[model samples]
Structures are given as C-alpha cells and as structure tokens.
Target: MKEYKYTINGTKYEVAVGDIEENIVTVTVNGEEYKVEMEKEAEPEKKKPVLGKPAAAAASTSDEPATNKAAVNKNNAVKAPLPGVITDIKVAVGDEVQVGDTIVVLEAMKMANNLQAEKAGKVTAVCVKIGESVMEDDALVVIE
Candidate 1:
C-alpha cells in the first residue's frame, strides 16, 4: 500500500492506495469511505524537435523568468477558501464576470457553498473542474 496526502481547500486527508491489480482504491476522507478507480499509468510521449527562427525566439523568451512574472501579473488568481469537492463551475474561460458572480460551487461538510468573484473582470483561466477536489488556497480561477 502507498500513502497519499490529498488536500481540498485547506483541509488535508491521508489516503492509502491498495489493490492496484483489481483497479480498486479505498479512500477515507473526513471519516467517510470512498471507492476510487485505479487507472494504469501511461508512458510519456516523445518530444519533437522544433526547427526555425520562430522556435528559437520562443525558446529564448521561455528561458527568461520575466515572462513568468508577466504571466502571473496579468491575472488576479482566485484561491479556494477551504478544502472541498467542486460541485459546479459557473464561469468559463473568456467569460466576462462581475463581482459577486458565482464562479464555482463547492461541497464541504455536506453543505454546498458558492464561491463568488471578488472583483469584476474577464475570466482568463479555470484551474479546477467539476467533481474535482480542491485544497485551501489552490488557484480556482484567474480574472483579468
């Protein structure tokens, strides 16, 4: 058996992975039992070589950390307030949203909580999908 730590919102759970050949995994979250499917890992694909000035230019820009800083500065990332399973996602990428708009619905402690936007802006990215568990302070969306 292998131990794994999963966090949703800010809460943490310790889970054990067992019976890989049977494709079954038993997880206890917050004292509740959950049966999960164990999928086989796939091999990584080979990377293809890029040739041309454009590729060189892209590679050069990627080598600089300034590009990363700029990307982070371009959007205001919203974080999860607590560990929970995402019940719904109300907004999509490129969607214009307003302050107080429901961005995601999370189920925690058997209660459904709506996560609203903090400010009015266009949604640039969504980090979590419906039915996915998220940890506290994890990026939920990016607004620009």
Candidate 2:
C-alpha cells in the first residue's frame, strides 16, 4: 500500500491507497477504510521508489550514512517544535540574528508559528526549504 499524510483544514489525515482495479481504489483515511470509484481507469504506472526500513537498514550497514534527513551543522541549532510545513525562512547563511528573532515561519494546524532564535548568533546553515515538511525536534537551522 502507498501511504500519504495530509493536513486539511487544520486536521491531519493518513491515507493509504492500494489494491487498485480498473476504475476502483481502496483508500484508508485516518483508520477508516473506503472503496472509491474513479471517473476513469488509471493508466499503467512505472515502479515505485523504495524508501523504507529495509532500505535504510541496508544503507546503515554499509559505510555510508543511513540518510541525509538528520544532518546537524553547528552546535547551536533551531529545531521545529511541532510537525509542520516550513513556509518561509527569514535569515540566510551568514546573517546575524539576535535572540527572539523570527528565523522561520511554520504552518501547523492552519496557523502560522514563528521559529525564533534562541540566542544571538550568525546563521550557519539552513537545513530546510520552503514547503518542506518537518517533524518535531527536527533541526531547522544552525547558528554559530
């Protein structure tokens, strides 16, 4: 099954699509299952990418890093307080920032939350881009 997480009207939903047939699909939304009919038959598709536990474990067993999702650049880093999409980044690399400065804006639960600098420092790295979804405690920017 293919899974997708979405936030709509401030509500979060996890949808799984699978067992597709001619013009019908099975979808599970937030634990509730539904059989949906499509307007037309879906076209043949290519293979899906593999990006799950097995692949990650295989990568970790090798010399290379398991993934690039958890990179930290500096000792000082601003992390996401909750799961959300990064709507904007106010500071660029080498930009000086003071405590309480709004470094980034995150959209969660249909609200805009400002991510501020914890201390005065220069921005060393921006780890997320616009429209990127971040999880709680994910490092957003590094300051030094």
Candidate 3:
C-alpha cells in the first residue's frame, strides 16, 4: 500500500493506493475505499537519473532508529494528529513517559509540532522514524 496526503482548495485528503489490476485500481480516500477503472492502460514512464540521493533512500539509510512494529500493541498505539513528516522521535521502547510529555516532533506546513503523550506509561513501540511521512491517524508509537 502507498499512502499520500493532499490539500486542494483548503480541503485535506488522505489517500492510499492498494492494488492495480489491468485498468482497474483500488484506492482509499479519507477512510472510504473505492475501485476506479481507467479508460485504457497507459504506458509506464521512463526513469530519470543523475540526481542527488532521493528522500526515500536518505530516510532509509539514516541513523535514526525505530522499533519493531510487529511487537506493537495496536490498541495502545499513539496515532498522528495530522499529516506530516516525522522530524524527531523523543521516546524509545522501554522508556517511561508521563502524560503531556513530548513523544514525537512532527513537521507540518513548515512548523514543528510536538506530539505529546496523552497518558503516563512505558513506551512499548516506536512506529515511525525521522524523515518518514505519515497521515492523520497513522500510528507513531505504542505505550502500555
């Protein structure tokens, strides 16, 4: 699945592309899923080379750390408040946190927003890494 966020005419939309079969595609927008059929199959675009390292590559190769999502308690996961790129992670697995403690820093619209914990607990999962982009409701951490 590929996720993307867009804002048009002051309306924000979170989109996720699921599968593609021939001219039909499965997509989800703002929590609503839909199947869209194309008029015809379009040719694939050629790749353009010779540029600096791509953002995705840089993010993957960065030293920033992340915890294993498979071990996360989904019920206790701390979800993102809005769409943004993760600028920093302030807590790690096994760390103790208090209510209102900044757990992550999210950069949205050029402003860094500190996402704080809602309840006190021990951090059990760090679902996002620095430079990673996330949409509203995406899980960033898990505390229990």
Candidate whose lDDT is highest: 3
Q: Could you tell me the TM-score of candidate 3?
A: 0.55
- Tens digit of per-residue lDDT, candidate 2, span 1-144: 999999999999999998988879999999999999989846799844332335434534654221323565545789999999877778887899999999998889878899999999888777776666789988888888
The window of 10 residues in a row where model 3 has the poorest summed lDDT is 47-56
- Stretches off by above 4 angstroms in model 2 are 1-71
Error of 3 at 21 (Å): 44
Badly placed stretches (over 4 Å) of model 3 are: 1-67
Which is the leading candidate under TM-score?
A: 3
RMSD in Å for all candidates: 18.3, 16.0, 18.1
TM-score of each: 0.49, 0.51, 0.55
Whole-model Cα lDDT of every candidate shown, in order: 0.72, 0.79, 0.82
For model 1, the run of ten residues with the poorest summed lDDT = 47-56
